[model samples]
Target chain A: MTLLQVAAFTSDFPDDMVEDEHDIIQFGGKGVSEAIGAILSGLGYSVGELDYQGERGWEFSAGAEGQQIWLLLSDLGDYLMLQVEDPSFMGLRPKYRQFREHFLSGLTDALNRDGRFHDLLWFAAVGDPFGFPDPAGEGGRRPAPQAWRWS
Target chain B: MASPPLQSRARVVTKSYRPMRGIEVVGPLARPEYESPSDIAAKARSAAAAYVDRHPEHRSKAMMAANIAGAGAGVVRGGYHMAKGLVDAAAFVQRAANPLPDVLLGRKTAGQQTIDLAGAIGDYVIEGRADPSRLGRDAKQAVANAKADLFPSATPVAANTADELARRFSIGMNQGELGANVASLAVGGPLAKAVGKAGEVMALQRFPAARYIAQGYSPEAAAYLAEPYSGMGSHWVPRRTKPPSWFVDSDYNVLKPRGITRGEMYELHARVDPKFSTARLPPRFADRSWRFEKSGLRRHGPLAQVWHGMPGATKAKGGGSLAAFGSGAHQLGEEGYQ
Candidate 1:
């Protein structure tokens, strides 16, 4: 099978109202989208389309062909839809089990590649998890894109 | 019978005499024959097999067989690199698990120093030059946070004293609470507003931790400090809180005092820019100028020479060539009336 370079990118974070931990809101949440993007890119997919929709966003195809991969870079701490990309690629709903499993495996697999795909960064504003908060009260995190190769 | 005996004796004596004059003995001196090609090949195989037999459980036998087999297989040799890679992988894994204690110690000390310095400065800012107690909870927390940033696993505690606080005054201080004060800063305000400010402080604090990490500190150390400041609304308590960005920003004025502009902080990491131009002046003074002269001009000689001409008027052409200038001339008779 042909391996195609693909990626999924978004800047959405969970709305302040969304309290459910299981919700896979595309761009909503913490570093999930960004993490997914990083994981996919690491797996040899070029994350191409990432558009923002205020509190929500979407990404096009992610991950490479002939490889178990789907990278979704959201604000939810670097999620990797790996070993299977059906839900992530199609932007499906509620990944209760698949999300958690894929996240761990994809993260490990990316880390185990030729380069450290796990080296992808997550930035939170100071009050945020790993970054600083918006000083202007825009309710958005600053995007500091640091690139990494897959391991 | 008597005549036959005499003739026999005479014949025996004649035969004995002939042998004594001409007899020569030969020794075995002929060269040995050479062996066949099959014999040499069989010897090599035997040697190899014997070596393997001696080490029955070792994989070296297989490796040897593989190496020998490879000779005619047309693959380029990579045994050395492969072996080195194996060694490196083993070493990397080992190192990842067991970090050097000495390195960790140094990192911790540096982090502590940073906290101490930041606290002292913060103290001076809050309580005037004399009131030693001015480095308040926020300042105390800043030191702790800075220390946390430096040493990820442990919290930095302050040793409050006149001398320790004095040193930080020298380093300079920017007024305001540290990233650690975020929990206290977040009030009963709407969740949307609280989260934003919280994230900002976290980002600002990440810089120094990032700096430390870049300087060989572990991410674990940075994370330890970041943990206290990362609490969300429900997670945080009131005692650790400080004023919001609006009140704090206006009250302390972070820009005027700290000298910690984003640009400056970024430059501190990149270690470049026009501000660093001051460092370039020293090397510019080359050997042409005397050390004393350079020192006299405060080592601004090169710049001075380049920008403005030399201190005094220069000598004119051939005004005093070494041949005729200030030297006791060596006299010689002209070649006898050339």
Candidate 2:
């Protein structure tokens, strides 16, 4: 089994943009559903609209193809969690790779447009989950991620 | 050329790359002439200061009025969040326990139940923090927008309408800047109220991002730091319990900086005597960064959604409020502390 290669970035996207309070983004209320919907729409995925339906709980879901990628505000309001199935087989790879670049660049650009989120840090994490038991091993410790931001 | 900023103790950090092409014709693009958020936020305060500078009497009046308005809005919003939280909690529990009547009944969706649960606690949690304690941006916007709202309409025609007889003699009731606000109050009051009320929702629902981009962030960060505007909504997380097959252990040189520094503010460099790599995955799939690759999560062993209309409906409802507020708080900064 190979190690999990994780890259994560941090910015100052506002919490008001989350509409966890209401089923719909309320008037004068901060919620990012609409903003997220706009991004998915830009990516050629016809983002779903909200109604009194089974899919309501999902803040945003872009399953345009059979790809299993979902963006949701977790029960914890901390990080906007992206739950992704392996895109290689979920959709065509080269194309999936394209989806990633346009999506990330567009997203970070759009969010950064608000101007509050800065010092955009990306963490390229490399850590092994499996290692023989040993006392002085770094494996027992949480992966101390190294991050650098794009200016 | 500068390399994209790289930081890794593990050796052989593969260089970053993009596909020769993309699925969509539109490649990565930047907004033309984009102004950063901080820049947009500064505009309002500067404009307000200029306006106040020009009119000292109005400055005193505006400042005094602003303090009252700011404190009032804070207290009101604070209370609203608290009361709303409690109400949401009750609704969450009520619907979560019995969801059968959701279709035209007392029922709420399972997710709704969870939301209300968190909202209730969140409301109380955020109450003490709601007021915009000296939030400069919003306050400046208020003044600028207020002037913008009242000025254009306060023309000679408006003066005529307000003081028609006085206007007939070419002398009108112009009571300085205060008069415009008063005129808007007495004349535009009922009709404007109706129109403003009708348009409030439509106006608010539109242009949030544009407005934020054009102007700035909410004071939620100032009073309580209730936000982290990170544009990470589309990031990939490892969903599979296992890594993909291609992940391979590899090696490369690790760069280390010698801690000892001379007074010239320069640090000596050192390299890891031997290089090491945690593992290597194909570069094309690097963006998949974090993964418990599904290769997908399906229990083909067989499972069924027995009752309550949806399978995880009950859990969604049960977990509604504050079981966990925001997901990625384990992150290094307040970025995850929604």
Candidate 3:
């Protein structure tokens, strides 16, 4: 599994919203991907086509502030985990708070309308020092992300 | 003839042996044979055990003696603190009542007197004579609540007299007592456990004789025996409720009159900036989060020097180094503006 190195926000949906793995892969995963794409596009970032890997997960590439960024939306049971990968955007340490504010604000605004996004059971911004270690020790000089749960 | 001769010879030999010049008779068998060190130690231990056994009340009597001594010491210390607190309180009231005499006497400046008064009040509060928890509650609201509870329909400000001060003080004291009682009851279980642990540590450190006795029994049994003496001192000390962050931020200063409400400020902020809205703010802002932010500034800014000088304020929450405060302030400012 890739270590999510940037600031990520996780929102767990109610059991009724996505009951099984199939539902998560089809409805929940697609919804999160589309919402993120729309948010990025609205913010003047050019979003690429959504790449779906069936039950595996889905992801998309986007260009924001003249930097290529990847949005990986994955399913973990009944929740959607959003991780941003910006190769040229530097480490998450310097821009943690900014990224958190921007991501939560955009996602909240996009989802919290007409009670359509009311299925959100919990929402939290994971702090810097994210992701698991590279088992092969190939990711050189990368700082291990610390787990932070900001409610 | 032979029997008669043998008897005569025995009598003659006995008489002659008494006059032998080179032979010496030993006295008391030469102090008996010297015993080994281990045998001597065993004998001593057995003697002690036997003596203790003979006087079954010895252990209880020793424990009682220790308890009495400890209790006496606790009482003395408690009384000292209580008296000191009373003196400080009296000094504070005197200065607060009339500041001109001290100023004219050139003993203390107005600022010095104010600092002293604050310190005295702090000592009083820390001594548990006053409720430190009540500092965070709106002052006006507290006074109103106290009035409603004690003297219904009587406003504290209506009478600007000594009697009014007395009445308000009485009400506050009652509230403080109630708060202390409630707090004690709430934390009774955990407090007892903590006290027990502390007592165990104290007993191990202070009593070598008890430890020797304890070696003869199981650890659990020994702990039970030493438990009573462990908490003797703590029993006399009052449980302290931590003062609120705002109180610490106020420079160990007395509570001030609140001028504005968070809601009103939120409304004002909304009106000033078109982009500003309550929806954009974190949910906690609706509650006491604004006060936390304000307090954070004092902890993380120029006001920190004053807080650091306070007795226990520096150890309290948000009372960190200047660099930490800078980081906290930056985070708070970012959230506040957002």
Candidate 4:
């Protein structure tokens, strides 16, 4: 099984905001959860409230013809984590990989167009167990695949 | 003429001296039974002065030795003072940064107050040795000054409201719980194995009757309980003894459990009391709040729960059963029951 986690600090965004201990990001008098929901909805994904493993967050599901995708988002104080998992029992690894790549690229593009988000400071991914690359870097437009790929 | 001299000597009244054995004795002198106090004192003074004059080097050596010993003692006393002061200073800073329960309980924190007391006692001894006249005054002043320096602002802020005290108590409780959790997690694997091994060894060391029970020996005829038995023809059968309870199953080779290993007990303990768990970020990550922000990511699902529970996740935050266990254990640890 593969697990993916993507986190970005709210403080790094151009919007002067802070996340409380409850992982609720407050910016422009609107919660980051609401913003994420809006963003996911605008991207043509079906977004809904998710309670996965007793963790409160948002779930995004979408499909185009044959390919289906699922994404889970949870708020961590000062950061947001998006977890992608394969719901189908079909042992297809490449499908999850492709979905992660497309989702990350689309999310990055959306954030860029939002104007409020200044940059993505860090990005990280893990394919297998203990597969984690270093996620340290300065603010930038979008992180290279090499930056988040585990060696 | 000799006879006339002897007669005259025998007369004695006219002679003032006597000759005997080549020595001449003068007339009898007046002898006092005891010397006067003044005379004795004078004689003693003169004798002492003469002795000192004769052994000037000895006097100087004694004086130098006394001075050196005194200086060495002073240096040792000073070193003690400095060391105690530094320790007390460090304790003071630690107590200030993280006020312990003892402070709120209206008691001095452990180790710190004892050190301060020792320092005070040392000061008293030093003062007494250096100057007995100023002993009380000097010792009291030094102690007061040291106390002031070390315990400045240590007075428990009287919590006017119960809510305030409760809040402080909660904060301290949470910190302690976190620390306990971190410690437990750090040593859980080894500790669990050790405990399991110890239990097995204890079971093995029991009396033969109990040991037999632990080895899964069933009660049958006393004759059949022997170590070796001639079964069927000439084939001897060994005792059908089962593995000890410490074994995962009847198989003596496999010590670890197939379903739940010994380490799982420790994980359970951590879940029961996260204070006993030591799972935490490294010091570098923990020290900086920003690092938590930048690196806040975790796994999910039942497999993730088996791997490790997230540190700060709880039931309120929608964590699973592990989180609930953590929360309950944290409360127990905080309440001093765990």
lDDT of 2 by residue, A1-151 (tens): 2212222223355544223431213211124445556766775766655211111123345545544344432111322322222343644566665665445555556555645433333333223221111111242222344433333
For model 3, what is the alpha-carbon lDDT of residue B26? Answer: 40
Q: Tell me the lDDT of model 4 at B284.
A: 24
Candidate 3 off by > 4 Å:
A1-28, A53-56, A92-104, A119-151, B1-338
Best prediction by lDDT? 3
Better of 2 and 3 by TM-score: 2
- For candidate 2, give the DockQ: 0.02
Q: Estimate each model's TM-score.
A: 0.14, 0.22, 0.21, 0.28
Order by lDDT, highest first: 3, 4, 2, 1
Q: Write the per-residue lDDT of candidate 2 for residues B92-148, one digit (tens) a residue.
A: 577667677674554446666456557766765575367555355556766654443
DockQ score of each predicted structure, in the order shown: 0.01, 0.02, 0.01, 0.01
What lDDT score is found at residue A66 in candidate 1?
A: 28
For candidate 1, give the lDDT of residue B137.
58
Candidate 3 clashes between residue pairs 3 or more apart in a chain or in different chains: A3-A131, A129-A145, A129-A146, A130-A145, B300-B325
TM-score winner between candidates 3 and 4: 4
